[model samples]
Target chain A: MTDWDGRRWHDMGGQAAGPVPMESHDFALWEKRVDALMVLCGQKGLFTVDGLRRALEDMGEEAFETYSYYERWIAAVNQNLIEAGVYATEELAARMAEIAARGPTYGEAQDG
Target chain B: MPHDHPDHDHDHHDHDHDHDHGPFHHEGMSPSGHPYRHDNDSPLTYWQRMEIAVRELLIDKGRITAAEIANQIEAMDARSPTNGAAVVARAWTDPAFKARLLHDASAASREMGFDIGPLNLIAVENTADTHNLIVCTLCSCYPRNLLGLPPDWYKTRAYRTRAVREPRAVLREFGLDLPANTTVRVHDSTADMRYLVLPARPAGTDTLTERELAALVTRDSMIGTGLPLRP
Candidate 1:
């Protein structure tokens, strides 16, 4: 309860957060990997966990709720990577474009 | 995938709308053997694509080896709720261990041979007069070393916002109907520290062994959404 910034959304203590369901679903393969990726990056001195939290905090509100849990992790890690000079933003865009051009290959491959 | 960062400052960065993508396919870019989940909309998700490029680029730059990343992944895979369950079970049977757990949770975990990572771990005991609930209202700042990654429900908007403001009601909805006189204390994990709820030992388990008692400790019990089973 102490040291919470009143204006921050994440500092929500004793706020009307939402309903707490008693169950949880299985984490998808990619979703499970994000933790390790982040830990590895952190262990390499690339960025701190606090830095990653800042990046997550910096995300747009809609984006915060829009993507799945690890999707946000991927975005936050990507942001930190580019900011840390470990990867170029331009390269990321280029690679994304390259894969996008491949045109959803899984369906076609599965059919063949 | 929806993070279209407004600060993405590139004059030529119309990476979104450019449709005249070339028919070029890099030699090793075959979809058949790539490390990707089969999403119908796109073979490789935006995040998967980014991971590949960033992972490769980091490797190319001599920043991190693929082995280290693999090792970390293996470590994460090895972690589970059993780590927390063992800790809680020991505290339930042994009063001295319970004192140590409440005093310094991470050290107590380390004493039990569980690596609790770098963040401080605090064990808040739930007593008859007081109940403790943990939440990371911002993001899912869980004690992964103890309980692994948080369950999907823990990261939901409702849980994040409601855990602090309406804990009693939220807990009730989770099937934890507390006594009206019990004061609920919702711990907000704002920083690096993570909180674990050492739920009150249920009655009639005095004869149960540590391993047998650990079986009664559910993941939600440690999260304070539910209580340990009564045996």
Candidate 2:
């Protein structure tokens, strides 16, 4: 075994792993919204990208496997925003519950 | 903050302008030549619900606007490998600009009219005896302002970990095998600092125009996982 580097699970440098997966897909509308939100929120000083990274890293390795890329990202974004006091967890919970009741499709759920 | 006033919002109901719904949406390919991913009518997901909630909350609080979000999406969509390719092609043809790029990549890219904001970028050059590869082991940090969103593999755990440990093996898996004498250098991208590999110009391409040369540069080439296309 190699000497320990004290790396976190998300700090994956120089570790053993499988072959790189080459398949890729273009960003969808919702994914792009997540990306835009991250960028704009950072620009507005609501939170830094570092803060988002911290939230993602803290979510642990299991979340990495279970969550898709932007899923993890939106979670991190929301975490950071809540930490930044941009919105309260209560507000997010209420909003999500409201959203969940809207419809079964993304478009139908767009409006309140 | 420039246009954060609530009065500027066109209408809350008009957010669907970005989506093309229904049966005819799959008629043609996106600019990347791949079919568009099915969105909108797909079964609503947990994460999708969170996105809708967060976006609506942000808009409701006047922290952001729907128009701004739409504009931001359009701006990001405009950025792609093509932007980096143009920068690489220019560096190959213009010695002064290449020096500027190697010195201060962010400024050099700004000189070309790419609104990169405050990205601190570095340009690593690939030579006959030296090769460069980029990875973000800590997170999926990338030079997105210039190269658009990173490829999905770039954010994978396998590539992130293996690229730093066994670069030659990673390169080979990417269908790139450096000669025995060539030294391989791997750069780990960070939150504040991003690297763009200046892939070496393919040989026998002296007669090609800048635009033609740009076409030969691929996304993987800029990331140093693959080389520019041969003429």
Candidate 3:
């Protein structure tokens, strides 16, 4: 698949070849893709909210807190995207509310 | 009393050397022109601090073992370089591969035996007539599975600020000056997905093996500020 610029994508070992343009709407598509991946992985119990909390504790309070700030910043960006009509407003609001209800607990409201 | 004064003077001189600065002339200066103070601002919020404390309490209560945590770090380190190299090699050898990567990066990466997650979100963008740069505007939400720990600058506020507003200028600062015809695309990696640039391979690498090509692709190149290694 070529990107918008019309470059071709080859598989590993340089053996396969095809043309596909990258979507102009990649950011929106990626968000949807990740949301799906999160559900799939969450169902498999690979990345649990509680597990992340424990991991943060192991990394120490300073690092964990910095990570939390990072999460908040991303959430704000998602909110902006929703405002810009880049994301679904209803979904964004629901997610934001869910995060808020988690009450700033370990790995509760924080996941990018 | 007079003898004590001399002794005190010597003691003060010793203290000055011990602090690694001569007798202080300015509150913020240490003989060097640079400020001698470190900013101690806590980057975390109050709630985050409380959460960390609570989590630690849980761990102490036997919820998780410290060894299990160490294992994660070991796993991450092992995964980082290989994933990075694979992406670089694929980009170098296959144009179609590069296209796929730019289209659906995570899936493409997985096909190469690499996982692009807890942040499975991936976006691939390309620039030829112009250059594109990537920065995690919020924090360093990098493709760590592919790239190792992001360089210090990637995580710095200076880079985040300049990368968006003045991308071309920032690239120049990194010693990457594109042709005037090149348009600069600056991507702010936010919540939905993160991005990695598919840098064009450098010349004179036609005969190199895939492994050798991978070695030439540095993390900075994927970030779009540096070129692949030469020779």
Maximum-lDDT candidate: 2
Across residues B36-114, which tens digit of lDDT does each residue of candidate 3 receive? 2211121323433332332233234454333443343344434544466678688668888877876788878887877
Q: Which stretches of candidate 1 lie over 4 Å from their true place?
A: A1-6, A13-18, A21-23, A98-112, B1-42
TM-score-based ranking, best first?
A: 2, 1, 3
Candidate 2, position A67, lDDT: 77
- Which pairs clash inside model 2? none
lDDT score of residue B213 within candidate 2:
100
Per-model TM against the reference: 0.80, 0.91, 0.52
The positional error of residue A22 in candidate 3, measured at the CA in angstroms, is 32
Best by TM-score: 2
**Model 2 Cα lDDT, one tens digit per residue, B1-24:** 111112222222233333433222
Q: Report the lDDT of model 1 for residue B180.
A: 90
Evaluated against the true structure, the overall lDDT of model 3 is: 0.48
Taking candidate 1, what TM-score does its chain B reach relative to the real chain B? 0.81
DockQ comparison, 1 vs 3, better candidate:
1
TM-score of 2: 0.91
How do the residues B1-231 of candidate 1 rate in per-residue lDDT, one tens digit apiece?
232222222232222221211231122211223322223223556675655566656767898766665566556656777788899999998999999999999999999999877879999999889889899887788888998777667777778878877788888798789989998888888557899999999999889999999989987889888899888
TM-score chain B for all models.
0.81, 0.88, 0.70
C-alpha lDDT of residue A21 in model 1: 48
* Residue B57 of model 3, lDDT score: 31
